[model samples]
Target chain A: MHMADALVSPAVAGAMYAASTAAAAYSVKRVKHEDDIKKIPLMGVMGAFVFTAQMINFTIPGTGSSGHLCGGVMATALLGPYAGFLTMIGVLLIQCLLFADGGLLALGCNVWNMAFYGCFVGYYLIWRPMTRRRLSGGRILAGSLIASMLTLQLGAFSVAVETLLSGVTKLPFSAFVAVMQPIHLAIGFVEGAITAAVLLFVYQARPELLDDKGKSGRQNRFSYKRTIAVLGVFAVITGAGLSLAASSYPDGLEWSIQQVAKAEEIEAEGGGVYAAAEGIQSATSLLPDYAFPESENRMGTSCSGIVGAVFVLALCVGVCYAIRFWGKKRIK
Target chain B: MSKIEGAVRELHRVDSIAGADRWIHRIYPSVKLILTVFYIAFVVSYGKYQLPRLILMGVYPIVIFILGDLSFFDALRRLRFILPFVCAAGIFNPLFDRKILFYAGEIGITGGMVSMAALLIKGVYSVLASYLLIATTPVEKICFSLRKMHVPAVFVTQLLLTYRYISVLLEEAQRMAQAYALRSPGQKGVHFKVWGSFAGQLLLRSADRASRVYDSMLMRGYQGEFSCAAVSKCRQRDIGYLLVWLAAFVALRIG
Candidate 1:
């Protein structure tokens, strides 16, 4: 799922951008270390292939609707995770700029959701495990299906969490999750089936491409556990840091908690933990009551604000056209 | 098949617009890129109830659209697919938030309604800001700027190559899709049974094309290093543009 800029707060967006950029840098280093210059063109072409492939939709049986290829797991299957992730970055960048399929600010989140999970988690956890012992028709199909579905599930869940954290929407967390997950489950199934079909076909046509026997040495040296541990720590640190930043700034996180607090009637338990947390929240809240001081002339001020906004917009348009007109006259 | 063709046409439209001769297009690509990011951040940073301030942020895109000599309707038309999703994202706001914020001529304005409007404006503003950046800056120049900003060469190279070849692959896919559609009359898409062969054939062909592309690169004495023909220096005007936009953004955020 492509997250729009509206769905993410600056804090969440910045954290995601940092995470995805780090991943891209790491992928670049890994790909360079391989020293196989041949992969550059292949990655490029495959990136384009994924781009075009996404445009070609196939109808799901009995659904009357259609789905297209996501191509993360499929790309990683052909190219390793590192290259696949980078290729995805390329495809997504083009999509953002050329078609505006996803927003630029949200590109980081989109990449992590669509690419990181599929390329890394889908590959290491599901695809590799399913096809580890040997390559077979059933293994290829099962691996693609499971990997696609699992990754889509993770991606969809992340989207729900991110939107909730952003607080731009009034959607309750449970309600948002309830809607996002099932829809993606269906999408994931279709994606999985298509991925399976493609991978199986490639396996039959050029089995050598799917064979990882030759690259086992390089692949084994890269420990998934160590990478995951490092990433886990990074995420934790970023989360804590962002939460602190968000608290001081009174951002979406605080707003969301307030919304949740209002929506759910929680009895104030006379417990040490509850008291301490409440104390912390009040201490950290920029607006302790989450509203500005009421003024007798509040209506007047709001009316003035709206009037000023309209005036500013008019002035902006006037200046723009004025300058354009002036420039054309000067040229003439 | 029409979807593929439509996408290719959209890509060309953006490319052609980016290549247009206009003051916005003439500015340094990196400057436009940075300003767009700043503008989006500024718009998104406002509180959900800050509808007035959010409305003020509309000035940036409106001015850019006029100065760039672009049609607002065309831009909106291009964004038709995404605008609905953005709007729908905040549709539940009014329901979840019912606290009255203000009164408008005997009608009470709830916080939810205000926030929903704010969110919709934020989405529109952010999308427009991004569209402006790409509409003004060519993809090549954008990549070049990325390289200058210390983005890795490998990634930049991949971006350029992928951009270059997207049309080629899209055409091939279109042809293949047409053939399939013709063969499977009344079918919605290629049958699931033939998906493997359909997409598989495309994949195999793409791989073969990649091999040939690599061969051509090697023959041209490519050694993994890409050189740009034109190097864009940050002129004084570009700096002025950046400073002006930064000042405006700061003023908007604080004013």
Candidate 2:
């Protein structure tokens, strides 16, 4: 579940952005040995692949709405916790920029809540141990299903906790739980099963994939530097890149709070909110609130979306080339 | 095709105010990015119970609304959908939290009330600020701004690529969803079994796509610095704009 712009406070959103970027950079650095040409393509392509996979939806059995693949778990399984996490960031970045899925401020929350938990916690805490213990296709399936569901649940819960802590949503714990938990539970269950199936399938077909050591070979301790550097760049890029796609909406938590909290509490133009808007007004320069002013045009969002896509593509391609150029220089 | 066309059509349908373009759209993307940082830092750092301060929090962004091209009501209409979450999250503070803090005339605003108020305020401020920024600037400009900011060229490029790719994927997803709906409109959502199978199929397909993308990189003169044709070059005004915005951001954060 993506967080929208409406439900966030500048404070919580900023803190999360900082935290997520920090973690993202850390993750990239963690994949030091894997920063070779082979991995580069995989990283970029896998990021794209995640997008396409999300496009095709699968029915959720009894539910009328279909559920698409949440790539966090799959990425973690293949790319290791660190790389997987960065990849998930890539996925969310794409969603925000091109798809108008998440808000700019909410991007931090989404990256931390949705991506962090799905890749790292799900992989290291649950999937790894579970899969390792059994090492069977069924184990991979079961592990992924459980990990994915748990991760989503945690991410959803984190949304509640973060919102509550940030004091953005007025909904009390009980009522908010009543609203968020069940819906997410449904989503989580479906996502988990989907994640499990993918994990199982991959395990059967390319058993060596997840075993980084078994594949091209693990990077030595000396190469750890690459991981840190790559991750640092990844975080900054995503933060600045998909920023164009950051929405003007309230995100999931804020939307939920507005539902439970009545009118007076949820005044749209109350001087209270208007005051803070001015500060932000002082703050934003380029994209302002991610969308242009009313005087622009109807196609603002789409125009912004197209711009964002180009931004991300260029950023990614640029970084790769720069590195290649650097590598060649060092060799010479 | 029509749905895509509709999105395109809707873009052309709406019209913006006069000075809106120069003030909002033409502003450098760096201004938006920095301001976002400034605003988020302010909102997230506040504790859950600072009610009066929370109420005061909303003024800054709303005042911007007052000055900007977008009317207050339009901004609210655009953001109202997300209010429920933050609003609801705080409402429960009163129910579980029985200890009352203040009795304001008829209403008894407790610690929960304070917390809820803070949350609602936070949600509102962040939402408003973000809305105003996006409403003004286009996405591509933001990327160029990021590049100018020296935000790791590789990362910026990936972001651009990823953003472009997702839309294609979304269309693909939409197509797949349409196919799915056509096949199983009568049936409930895919069963868990089918759901897993379908998702797995997507992931595997993604992996293949990833491999193919990697190959293409070699074929092209992919030396790694990801540049784009979206922007021709920087404008002379870009420097002046960035400086003015940076000054304002500092003033707000310090205050």
Candidate 3:
């Protein structure tokens, strides 16, 4: 699932944006350093290939829900990881901006979770090893399934951790993990199967396209092992750090209320600008209850307050509309 | 709408809206991009219980809808698909966070309910703000802005080319689906068994097309860097756009 902007805190979102931007910049450098003009068109076309393929949603069995292709594993398989990473970024950016699939802040999270893992980690760790020298269907199938599933699991878990770090949702880390992991596992399997099938077909139809740049999978395997190890440690540190903060902070609503209440108590104990603000508030207290004059019960007061709020909202909307009309007339 | 048809319509709708020349639309793409990011971050920075304050951020999207000449209801409708994910995650809030924070009549409004409201509001406002960005700025202009912002040229070129070819490849996919539908009457979308082959064939076809495109590029004195037709210049209005949105966003965040 694409992580929505609301799911992340500014800190988590900013951190992710930085991470993804660095990774993207590295990918761009690698792609640029190569400067292979032939591969440039391949990158663009393959991105579009993934985008179009993603549109053809397939009905998942038994659940009746439809799922589409992610295309990351497949893109990585076809165009080595660096180029693959760039392509996935392009696809996701278009999806975020044009389709509104995800928000701008969360785009960083999406790119890292979806593209970075699928291209770099999945490519080196799983797909490369499985498809070495042999173009067999079984190898392709097994590779895609494992790689796609791994990337998706990592992506989904990252989303869970992001929300945990954001601490915006009341979803406990365990519960979020429990819910996110299994669903993505299923999606990952389906996407992996599709990725395998397509890659297998492409390999059979034209083997050269699949085999060219993915030549040094063995050389990179060593580095990836260390990369994966480092990532594991990083995850643990962040997860522990964030969960600690999450547990200590009461839910956002209560925390804010406590802060406000604490501030008000302090204001009452002292006196200054607070007294002036209180004087003004008291002066404008028409009903002395921020509600209707005849309202007796708490429910009545709340209802009247709601009515007044709606009235003010309507007035605001009317004024905006009037301004728009006036602005259009003046422009004409 | 069928998923494919809806995808096509969405692609066209944003492209058409971005072509509009209103004040919001005319604002520099980089300025709009920065504002969109700032607005979303501001909306999301609030605590989950800050629903009322979060609601105030609705003015940004509402004002955008009016100025950008976007259809409000249509924008909301486009967001409907994302609701299920938000709801699935949010539905558990009330179940998990049962500490009663306050009460309205006999009903106790728990922390879960308040946080859930905050989550939903955050999701809606952020999504709407992003929708406005795309609705007002064309993809080409966005790529130009990204380039101007010092994004790597190769990456930007890929983005531009990929966007340009999405519609073309989608049409190709549409044709393929139609042909398959005509032959396999009473079938809904391409059958699962055919998906692999169908997607494989599409990839193969596109790969061939890409090579042909490369050949054409070579014939036309191909350069490594792809150049854009549009010149990106930040006029005075663009600076004003950036400053005003940044100020508004900062105010929202602090207030």
Chain B TM-scores across candidates:
0.96, 0.69, 0.93
What lDDT does candidate 1 reach at residue A253? 40
lDDT tens per residue, model 1, A238-266? 56775664454555544565587773334
Q: Write the per-residue lDDT of candidate 2 for residues B153-251, one digit (tens) a residue.
A: 545555555554545444554565566658866664445565545555555665676677767876887766556546434466766655655564334
Which pairs of residues have clashing backbones in candidate 3? none
Q: For model 1, what TM-score is found for chain B?
A: 0.96
Off by more than 4 A, model 3: A59-67, A216-222, A240-281, A285-315
Q: Please provide, for model 2 over A1-332, each residue's C-alpha lDDT reduced to its tens digit, 9 standing for 90 to 100.
A: 77765455564566678878887776655555455545655665567667656544556655567676677887777777666677778778645543345666689999988888777667656776676545886777677778878888878877776555444444565666677788887787777777667667667666676573213334333133543464466557545643432444454444565677743254456567787887678566444333345525323433343344345445545555565567568979
Candidate 1: which docking quality band? medium
Q: Give the TM-score of candidate 1.
A: 0.90
lDDT for residue B27 in candidate 1, whole number 0-100 = 90
Interface RMSD of 1: 1.8
lDDT (Cα atoms) of all candidates against the true structure: 0.82, 0.60, 0.78
Candidate 3 chain B: worst-modelled 10 consecutive residues by lDDT: B48-57
DockQ of model 2 vs. true complex = 0.16
TM-score of 3: 0.89
> Distance from true position, residue A46, model 1, in Å?
0.2
